[model samples]
Target chain A: MFGPFRLTNPLSGGLLWKIPWRLSRHQKYRQRERLRKVDSIVATLDTALARQGESMRKLVRWKAEMPTEEEMLPKDKYTVFDRKVKRYRKAIHKLPKWTRVSQRLNPPGF
Target chain B: MPYFRITLMRSGIGLPEKTQGVLKALGLRKRMTTVYHPVTSSVAGQIMRIKELVDVKEVGTALNKKQMREARRPAPGYYVERRGTAELEPPQ
Candidate 1:
């Protein structure tokens, strides 16, 4: 006979998120779509400002500096540099609300 | 005078209250709902707070609720040009 389930998280004793170590193909596809959508939004905003002969400081900065989705490397796309994680790299999905937050930029010299 | 046309692309069902408050402040209550605001740093900052959940575009003018709905409506594929004459039409 089996005992208890013995599948409890020591810290919370609640539902624990079993985050995977690597990104799945579907997840990678979705992440790509999200990044591209943000890029297009920025592009649309920039064009709209040009039409009106006006510009927002942040928009200008974004257009000037932010890398497009196509420009990012595969490693950066799937994992982010984290000082706490082993080897200073962690899967992007491990972050809380990862889908609802943009983790595009990594710390320089990381 | 350009305005930011922001549309909520994702739900805030399980997100933090602060994030939900930001979306509420932007007048986005549900997914695919759009709101427009003049391009200001304060408004931009709010958008930044929930950027991953929205799709933003810059437009010269904002459309009203009716216009937004109309824009989303699909065109009819076929039109009835002739009036029906026979009560019992043969089935093809």
Candidate 2:
């Protein structure tokens, strides 16, 4: 036979516990919104980068297999690929650099 | 000074020779290999060449090989709370 006694729950109520439910709900919502924005940005960048990488790879393969001077293609053809390469290079440069420091960590003037 | 924390995320197995050369020049010999370099135009150019194959972050400090190794090491699950007196006993 066991004796019965009511056990008081130490964690049932506290000032610290009450504040977080309201504060954390709003904080979590904001965090999720920020994360979603970041995810979309990253997804877009990844797609663009992947496309650029594929085009660059194709160009490299074409250049590698292209004819030598003795068996050259037309001047316009060579120049077209050259222009494409230049454009790809420029686009790569134009894409934002992946350096993103947290605002809190960044220096005052940076 | 700002340093680039570059990790090779993909292999250069089928990539162009020049791309592979750039990876080698960056001191990244294999996938997941990391290297650090001072932030400079030259380093930026090198990274641009293989940007698609790398993950990069600008960090405030560069870690040496030993420090990098230590950073990747896992925490020990157990800790010794007391020392044993086995050494104090005579050889038996």
Docking class of 2: incorrect
Q: Where does candidate 2 stray beyond 4 Å?
A: A1-110, B80-92
Residue A81, candidate 2: how far off, in angstroms?
Answer: 13
TM-score, predicted candidate 2 vs. hidden true structure: 0.42
Each candidate's number of clashing pairs is 0, 0
Per-residue lDDT of candidate 2, residues A59-92 (tens digit):
3442365332334322211122213443322211
What is the C-alpha DockQ of each candidate? 0.38, 0.02
Residue B62 in candidate 1 has what lDDT?
A: 82
RMSD of each: 6.9, 21.8
Q: What lDDT tens digits, residue by residue, belong to model 1 across residues A5-79? A: 654564347757676788999999999999888777667656665665666788777767778899988878889
lDDT over C-alpha atoms for residue A105 of model 1: 81
Best by DockQ: 1
Chain B TM-score (each prediction, in order)? 0.77, 0.82
The list of candidate 1 runs beyond 4 A from truth reads A1-17, B1-4, B13-19, B38-46, B58-61, B70-92
Quick one: best TM-score, which candidate? 1
| Cα distance off (Å), candidate 2, residue B54 | 0.4
